[model samples]
Target: MKQSTDLPGLIPVFPLPGALLLPRSRLPLHIFEPRYLAMLEDCLKTPHRLIGMVQPNAVPGRDESGLHKIGCAGRVTQFSETEDGRYMITLSGISRFRVQSEVDGFTAYRRCEVSWDGFDQDRAPISDTDCAFDRKVFMRLLDRYFASQDLSADWQTLEDAEDELLINSLSMLLDFSPEDKQALLEAPSLGTRRETLVTLIEYAMRGGEGDVMQ
Candidate 1:
């Protein structure tokens, strides 16, 4: 897939805590809410079918105060509309972005002015040689973490997957706290993300208290 040269200055955002999208990864979303359904309809008419995936700072009920500054921009790669006016869509991550400012919009869903200056590297393919990731230690820690959580994965498939996919997929799929997931999303490099993931797993194994995904 070719990288998008013309990333938009303004983007529609979906702020769901603990839901993560990393560059070159894919996230599947179910759009049923009226505002989001409208957002999707509007996005589908545009040339750039992009949506920003961000995490809310506070839980949905407590406050509607704010969202984290960093997020990943994804393009709608696959979409299906239901007879009941719902959408099941898959977004393929394009790049990571920083929220420069919020742009007030007429739509019920929020919009933001984003800057991708620092995350240009996200536009390129990340290879195993790109960073010093300790795969051996990561796997060991992951094994222990999985056992403790009573989670099972297909080891053969995971081991065969590409480095970037393995790291980002695990980061998105794991049941980490919103803060931890945001931390993973904001990690500057693949190596840094791998290390942070290992640390989180270790902390969980040590009985550290944190909120699980609701």
Candidate 2:
């Protein structure tokens, strides 16, 4: 299902610097800013209220600067309103998009024309190079990683996941640098992405943080 470049149901987007949303993965977000809270409200009003999540290098006057060109569109699948009126929303990524141009809108949320190049509306096929043996090794290391970090995870459910989920979750757990995440986002195929993620994890585990993200 290739999304039309001219898809008519474009929604408001919120750009989050340094976060990457992969397909079939869920990103939890806290929406507290007034502008973003309004965006969440508007999204709730629509059936498919989607927003683009991107990272900015710095915030500018506040220290977090401008945004990166690439981002992923996520739909607000689950949301709740807190006592203080803050919003807790779960963003489920739909697809990747390259920013084409920003649109001037009255709302605080930014709007942009996007091009779906790396991600069409479908998952790229897994390649032969992504062998089962390597995947097993990655899982073993992943278990060690979880244990080392004292993270609670469902191992049974994890064991049932396909290669793609395993790789995506691994990527998130490694907390790869933004640049490295971008590289994974731009990977041409699933096998290649998996391999790159594995390499990144191995490198990070070897005390190579500086080189990992760059």
Top TM-score model: 1
lDDT of 1 at 153: 92
Candidate 2's displacement at residue 136, Å, is 1.6
Residues forming the 10-long window of minimal summed lDDT in candidate 2: 121-130
- What's the number of clashes in each of the models? 0, 11
- Cα lDDT of candidate 1 equals 0.86
lDDT values of the candidates? 0.86, 0.70
Error of 2 at 93 (Å): 1.7
Instruction: Count residue pairs with overlapping backbones in model 2.
Output: 11
Candidate 2 whole-model C-alpha lDDT, 0 to 1: 0.70
C-alpha lDDT of residue 49 in model 2: 71
TM-score per prediction, in order, is 0.90, 0.81
Clashes of 1: 0
lDDT of 1 by residue, 25-138 (tens): 999999999999988989988898999999888648876768889999999999998899889999999998999888986999999999887786788765423368767777
lDDT of 2 at 71: 73
RMSD of 2: 3.6
True-structure RMSD, every candidate: 3.1, 3.6
The residue pairs that clash in candidate 1, if any, are none
